[model samples]
Target: MDVSWVDGERRRVTRICDALRIRIEGVARAMTSDQSARTLSAESADVPDGAYSGDIEAVLITEEQIQQRIAELAESVAARYADAEDDLVLVGVLKGAIMFMTDFARALPIPSQMEFMAVSSYGSSTSTSGVVRILKDLDRDIAGRDVLIVEDIIDSGLTLSWLMKNLATRHPRSLQVCTLLRKPEAVRNIVEVADVGFDIPNDFVVGYGLDYAERYRDLPYIGRLRPAVYER
Candidate 1:
């Protein structure tokens, strides 16, 4: 055999080996990236359900999770309403928004006042009637005051739309909305929300002031209700 030919053949083999090594390293790196992404997705999906005496299917947002987000939202709110002349007024829709109103109000850095308005749309059904009536109105006049409508969730956006229009007639200096949860798919009206803690899936969720037949509101975390619990 020619010695020079043998040397050339060995050089070609070495080149092939190096190329394979580089290809294998690329594959490994890609697999690692994919695995890391999957891990993060799984961790985000697996929120821990707290020890609550309710038929919750899965915890959507834990108490700690909500509080953390609320802190961030408070910072945003304070910045937005910092230069207001009068103390900011937080108008909470009754029953459902009570929990969120209290927690978020305490989180705010600026001084604010709180009021409640009881409006009824859902009597005992999961769906809205699109007809909102004021069960209870605000005691203090909102005229010339910066009003923030705090709500637990914005499902169809109809009730909030109606509320905003109704309050607009009261002649508030400014009106804005801040909600803990919002359903993107369920929004029928173009209600501008100042801050939203979470844009959740359009599912029946109960907990943290949201309820089914006025139950599960005391649960420390927000959770998706089991089908059997609500369907029946």
Candidate 2:
């Protein structure tokens, strides 16, 4: 007998449910948007000058700056060897050049192969000893191949000069250099570099695969090591 009222009641309840569902959905969207904004802020936050346990005196180059330079270096190198017959061979100076080599390879527009050689002129010392030694040698012969020597940093140019002479014996079709960082001393020295990412000061820097006694290589950005850390 009251079926009409029941229908009205049902419609009212349905409307309430729809309204509640809409409100819930709106709250969820708002929460999601807020979370995304927070994530973006965290990612874009500026890295502090003394971010690395205060051991780094100052940041020489930020991570973003390093990456951008690397990309530009890669493009320049690729353009030079764009018409090469064989894939470019990247001869990375090991331990130090590992990071630059990998990143440069990935950024290169052309296909390339990798080889590493470990040469040392500075054995835990801040300055080069002026004597270069080969701690490791290339794994494969590079005869007749276009070779690019990837270096992390060149300070005095002793190690790079020695490496160039050594690699020259292999008779690569073409040999050139690409270094991520270089010092004023390196600039004065006569080693011809095909590409340089950044020409930094003569200060002792560690990070981005450059290190002082193997400590600061893991840092994302290049930084000057405090004199206290290595001077004593």
Candidate 3:
């Protein structure tokens, strides 16, 4: 029988696993006498409908885990900017990275200020067009200051690349990028990245500030969206 993991251990796992058409051969492995072992979910896995949908093949990173990484990133940033006579400007890409920005800035040992920007490439679909546009701009002057671009995801790096180029024209002392999730294949532009939290596959996730149709951002943990919900 095909076996799959349902994000639970005993009873709950059994419930979810039982609901699927596939038979259980093992835990998250062995597609049974049917198809090959599939991942937990899909790229546009994060969803906002039904009791249980958007359960894609996902590895959840907890708030505490994210906090730990932010701490490390803050330390690294603190050391680099320590020699500067001025305070650092943290520019967060809005919506997704806002929470991380707040926490990361709080973790910094140095004095700092924050600015917000909103840019999008996804339009109304699950995939990005690779062409990014600014929905909002920074309110503070970035000239001759140490700036850090905080982002939730670094996929199809076009947006970030454009951002770097645009920011450079203003002549910031230095512009560095810090992203929570970095996808190697999705980056289309070259930019100097400072610190990265996790390297993940190109899959959609909602929660911990990320969203699926602006839903699930309140979820404490990140998860792979279940496919059955979206495949329909």
Query: In order, what lDDT does every prediction score?
Result: 0.77, 0.76, 0.67
The 10-residue segment of model 1 with minimum total lDDT is 33-42
The lDDT, on a scale of 0 to 1, for candidate 2 is 0.76
Deviating ranges (above 4 Å) for candidate 1? 1-54, 186-188
Candidate 1 structure lDDT: 0.77
Ranked candidates (lDDT, high to low): 1, 2, 3
Candidate 1 lDDT by residue in tens digits, 1-232: 9999999998778656544543344334323421211001122334454555447777778788889888988888899899999999999998999999999999999999999999987755688878889999999998779888999998987788678767766667777778888876434345556677787777798888998888889887888888888789
Q: Which regions of candidate 3 deviate over 4 angstroms? A: 1-59, 187-189, 229-232
> Which residue runs does candidate 2 get wrong by more than 4 Å?
1-51
Would you list the clashing residue pairs of candidate 2? none
Model 2 Cα shift for residue 27 (angstroms): 66
TM-score for each model: 0.77, 0.77, 0.72
**What's the CA error at residue 146 for candidate 1, in Å?**
0.4
Instruction: Estimate, for each residue in 1-232, the C-alpha lDDT of model 2 and write its tens digit.
Output: 6999999998778656544543344334323421211001112223474447578777778888788888878877788799999999999998999888998999999999999888878755676787888888988988789888899988888888778766765667767778888777876666657677777777788888988887888888877788999878
Q: lDDT of candidate 3 vs native?
A: 0.67
